[model samples]
Target: MAHAGTVSKHPEGFEDYVKRAKLSMPPEELQGELDYWRSRKVLQRMLDGGLITPDEFHKIDELNRKTFSPKLARLMA
Candidate 1:
């Protein structure tokens, strides 16, 4: 079973995308994107449970955005 609110838009995309990115994309950037999403999920949970404020979430999110410099995912944006 999948986790809540995190279903893939293109279910088959994961294998192909990750394979391609691993073969072609910079490892650190790809790793950063992966880590950001992982952190985002935990952060979201904290927000939902009122462990953190919206301001705190947005602030850290902004920092993640800058620190990650996400690129490949922008293709879907």
Candidate 2:
């Protein structure tokens, strides 16, 4: 049954929510999310300023796919 303010047919109970939050990212992983956005901004600026060609930017994107750990990628996704 749904809890107050929750629409899920089988709303996760409070304990489940607490456990899921506890299993979520550690401080380091949070920091990595910040770093990813920062680096993405830099890449975007480079593209905007014409400092890097589209092809070059794409190459860097490809590199990022390889560089960011799969776990980080999944978290970001």
Candidate 3:
């Protein structure tokens, strides 16, 4: 079902999700989401290079951005 201000889940690009999620979040939350994505990208690169042990990588990745807020949590997921 459609609702006012709802955006589709099938985002076309990174900015698409940013634009849509921004509508439902405050400035602080939006920034946190951006930070989470940035950190995740770094972690992914480290994994690809085999710089981190798998257990260590999973431990770091398991840290909850949800402890921040819904918007950040969405980005973490």
Candidate 4:
């Protein structure tokens, strides 16, 4: 269960939050943001094209979180 996907637009200001959070971060943290977004872009493209199943996308999303969290933690520190 690992397919690519995009984050649908959220009306709860998540996009703004992500932007602001990235700007407020230190250099290392900003790099983490870059990495996260780059990976996300790949997923987004697949999703936008109606390419992945929900279960597969969910699994990939979970993997993304797991893969990036520790890296972000190190950057934040």
Better-scoring candidate (lDDT), 2 or 4: 4
Q: What's model 2's lDDT at 50?
A: 90
Each candidate's lDDT (Cα)? Answer: 0.62, 0.52, 0.57, 0.53
**Which segments of candidate 2 are over 4 A away from where they belong?**
1-24, 70-77
Q: Give the TM-score of candidate 4.
A: 0.51
lDDT of 1 at 64: 76
- Give a tens-digit lDDT track for model 4, residues 1-77: 22233333333433454654454544444444445555566776787888987676667866866776524333322
In angstroms, the error of model 4 at 22 is 7.3
Best candidate, lDDT: 1
**Candidate 1 runs further than 4 Å off:** 1-24, 72-77
Sort by TM-score, top down from the best: 3, 1, 2, 4
The digit string of per-residue lDDT tens for model 3 on 2-70 reads 233443333234466576555766555555555555556777789889999878777776673444243
lDDT of 3: 0.57
Candidate 2 local lDDT, 12-72, one digit each (tens)? 2423432544556654544444444445557879999999998998788667656643234
Worst 10 residues of 2 by lDDT: 6-15
